[model samples]
Target chain A: MTATVPGVRRGAGPLPRALHPGAWWLWALCLAVVASRTTNPLLLACLIAVAGLVVARRRGDAPWALSFRMYLLFGAVIVVVRVLFRIVFGGGGGETVLVNLPEIPLPEAAAGIRLLGPVAAEEVLGGAYDGLRLAAMVICVGAANALANPKRLLKTLPGALHEIGTSVVVALSVAPQLVESVGRVRRARRLRGGVGRGRRAVRGILIPVLEDALSRSLALAAAMSSRGYGRTGAVAGGRRALVGTLVIGGLLGVCAGLYGLLDGSAPPALGLPLLLGGLAVAVAGLAAGGRRVRRTGYRPDRWRGAELLTVGSGLAAALVMHLATEIDPADIYPSLTPLSWPEVSALPLAAILLGLLPGYLTPPPPTSEVPA
Target chain B: MARRSVGSAALGALLALLAALLAPLSPASAAPGLARPAAGSAGFCPDASGVTVVVDFRELGGGRVVRCAHGPQADGLAALRNAGFTVAGTNRWGDAFICRINGRPGVDSEPCVDTPPSTAYWSYWHAGDGENWTYSQRGATYRTPPEGSFDGWSFSLNQEEGSAPAPGLAARRPSDGGGSDGPGGAGGDQGGAGGDSGGPGAGADPGGAAGGGSSPGGPGDAGELPPDAESDVEDEEREEEAEEEPDEEPDEDVDDDRSAEAAPLPTEDAEWSGTDEEFEEQSAARDDSGGPSAGTVATLGLLVALLGAGGLTAWRRRRAAAASTAGAGADERPADER
Candidate 1:
């Protein structure tokens, strides 16, 4: 952009340009929604596999990018904890007893409550399925985080939301920076040969790390201010109020609209019309807000054909899943009592597979952009 | 005198209601002939007027059905048995598969099928208001059918067959009990099967056995045996059961709770002596057929996949860290030289 060249190529191949961060987020959200539609472990497994494959293939070599494994670790912990809770609470109904804990008979007052007794296989299974579904959604979010550049994503936000977006980008960068600071302090202490045992070790590492963090944060704040962080030009008070009202009102409308959109059982009056109204109000708010904040752009990101294709696949997956719920709600939470194969429809399954389209169509992240 | 009689009658009725509520498993005094206490469910299907039970003798060439108001039976199996279907089962898979209906048993060609069944046998399903059938996960004895729906027994020949096929024959429409009293349940006369044993005590009985015993013949000959020989066997069994029937002795003392509870009609001990209380105790029963949840198996696979991906990521991170540290050492030497 500084060189004033259009479509400049560093390499001769198609894999030179990085994918739009919006595309990654949109793709991940679509896959997460699909995971929510079914408790069928088979379908959920397929979904998790798709997400893992895509994230692995597309993620760049960045500190934030390395955090996806931590998400998986969190998911495993969630599943194990869920199963453990089931063992503790659920029993009495199912016949197949895996383990029999001591049955403490409560007084008649606690009629329905059972404590540490036989753990049923059915309960454990149900818990695992539920936990897996939730973990899948969480990891999908993590995948979006790993693959998308937080700073790049902040740029794509509407002007009205820029301040909020910037703060979020800063907050995300803090954890990795803190880890780097700790590593540096530890190495310095080792070189000085003063990392004493117990209390002495704590004083050696803790004070320097805290001091470093404070100084770095102050430096960052100074840099941001010098670069004109909040330099919106003087505006009429009425216009400011109107802009605030439009954004606030638009946000409330969007929340209500989203509630209606996600819940199919909600009334028609509360659904499509409200969602459309919210979107319209939000757009108007963004346009008004964009006028006041003036900043030089080094080449605004383009919404290319590939971006549309990438996001569309995800949208299609989510939309098809919502459609599937309307068609047969039973297919979602498959019953264990009857012991039949959880119904997996061809259309929804195909849509879930289609969600993987972004991995192929978008250009892979170039190694040069990654920090050494 | 009229006032006193009314008071006594009311007290007796109150005592009966009190006993019924207290016992939870007490048969209604109004219909004594209905042996088992009926557990009432709010019938969901508004359109369905009355109960129509269909019995399908799959691979046995024929089946039979009985139409009745929701009657007294301990559970669904007892309900079918009281309706005169000779149901058979092993110690395992309680009522999962009905081996016999109307004396026909499963053979080499035909098996008593279970759904996702290991063998070629029949599976029982109860249609609870909905058109779709629920394969009974709980034993029929534990679950009663919501009235006005169909309880079907279908034999699955193979694993791949369209599951839970309805009985071949249509359920018979409700009968008017005709001349032969068709289980009209003449509660006082205590007629029907038990009355057919015709003791001299029953002959002198004040209430006439008015209704005829009008049970339908099996569509299959049911291996028709000589009636004379069968009657003697039935008579011996009935006499033995009659001895075991409750309300045998009425106590004069009203204060004893046990006497009040045991006695069906304290005023008339004579009637209960002949009345057969069909209380089939499901003795020494344990459910043995359940397996590990199939969905859990799939989730375990999902968990394994997540762990594997995580391991790969960790391995790559360690390698990258090693290379970067080695380079940092090289860069430190250059800085010292400069």
Candidate 2:
């Protein structure tokens, strides 16, 4: 049985190990950045495909790993809702009328806002493009969730954020834990020959599941407290205040910087310079605060060549998309007035293909002993 | 079995709903010929029966192109469109916010995907004959320009609402050829100086000359003559016309000199004629014509290929897991018995 297990077999390949969670997050974020830049359905579809492929090839047998489909379903829902809204709201005034729904007249107070007007192909296509961009962004984040181990990610959080990380990890795990608890309660009920249906069955399962989850959380909290998980070493109040100020001020600067960068009319000084300065200050603050929480890792995930390759490929994809935006914005944002087919240029397509590097380059995920 | 049946029923209902929605879709008439107003000469409308559309390319550098939207137009947007110039609206605001005129400030300068920054945008103005330009409170789509009124669009860059430059040409119609030439000629010369010193010299000349009561001569200079020797043609026409109509001949000469200085612009005005068909064709080419290009096909193929690869990997992984689970179950049972 041990020999049959691929992970346990010797000399099969490089010993399977999970890549750094941060690398996956950075890579996914870069892909999301690429998604935000363009409304071209073709490019967005390419991005979605690349993300799905990576997630399929690299996701482990974990509860979160199975949630990518949920994200895809959610993305589809977004697209449907967006298109529906366009149909209802006059379809952005195009000549190519698709569906002439009866126009609903509103009171004089709600002038300029139409309801149930003629739907145009341009409007529907515009909504799809906008929705696809958003969906691509969501799926990229989902890909990261599936590819990276949330527990490992929590462990890798800065020492200053240990308490916050603990809360986040618990919150992240709650859905899966609730699902497990419900399953266990259902199985127990079935074993006892209680085949109640609907409301009664829900009542029977819900209470026990809640009780089980509460007890499990209590036990986890107790274990963590005993292990000194969130212990803060002696730190001066003045130092703590300074760190807080730095962080808050830095965050404010970052917010302003991002606003400036996104708004076309904003002054140039408020953009890149402010963003870089804020980042530097935030990093310094984090480092200072980290010293107060004296903690060590058992087996820390190292930033290896695989991690570099993963993050670099993501950055390359983002860079290429940005370049494409500059070089051929017309292709990136296809005109919808006449309702033309969305097209993707070669460079941007190749850049999105580069996003597939980590799936092939990184070592395969360690297989779980339990079948999923 | 119950769950599968329920799912299939829901899908069938969805399909039915889709069919119902699609049933109302009539075959769209391809490229409907829109009611476009006839292209007019550079000045205000020759009479009160039309709406003159003045597009001032301020800072964008093309000078003003005044075209008349003939007939009774419904609204400012309709008039602008009818005047044979192309108008592009922002994606977010639809026709509420005018983003481009005749494709000025190209996509590189302004993407037109969203509400343009307030600092740089086309400011709409309205004026009655001989009245000062007033900033319009309502959007172009909402406001109806009265026949013989002026609908102006000036590109406002880094200017406040109060300071936003109106169209350089004043709202003065051409005088009815006889005694009105005194005030009209004075207005024309003032407009000429304003046009010459501020931006391009050509836009103001025709308006000036037309207002000066030599309206026929001004149109003849711009429309009848070729672009290269427009100034010479204007001089010869001015001399001959001056001989025939000596009353406003001096004003026509002064206007001709200014028009001569900015001669190339009149050629543009002449070329701008018959743009309605061209504009429609351009839009049709952009919107309807092209099938998917090679790049689009390649992108779609790549997407499909990736999806297929991903599906294959998932299938292979599921099969491997099933095999491993069977092997593990057999080994565990034997060990338990032992």
Return the top candidate by TM-score: 2
Query: Best DockQ goes to which candidate?
Result: 2
Candidate 2 chain A worst ten-residue window by lDDT: A1-10
Clashing pairs in 1: B111-B121, B112-B121, B112-B122, B113-B121, B113-B122
Q: Note the Cα lDDT for every prediction shown.
A: 0.51, 0.65
Error of 1 at B203 (Å): 34
Model 1 CAPRI rating: incorrect
True contacts kept of 2: 0.35
In candidate 2, what are the lDDT values of residues A85-166, reduced to their tens digit?
8778764466566668888889978766789887766666667667777888888998999899989989988876677888
User: Where does model 1 exceed 4 Å of error?
Assistant: A1-13, A263-272, A326-330, A341-343, A368-372, B1-338
DockQ of each: 0.03, 0.21
- TM-scores for candidates 1 onward, in order: 0.56, 0.77
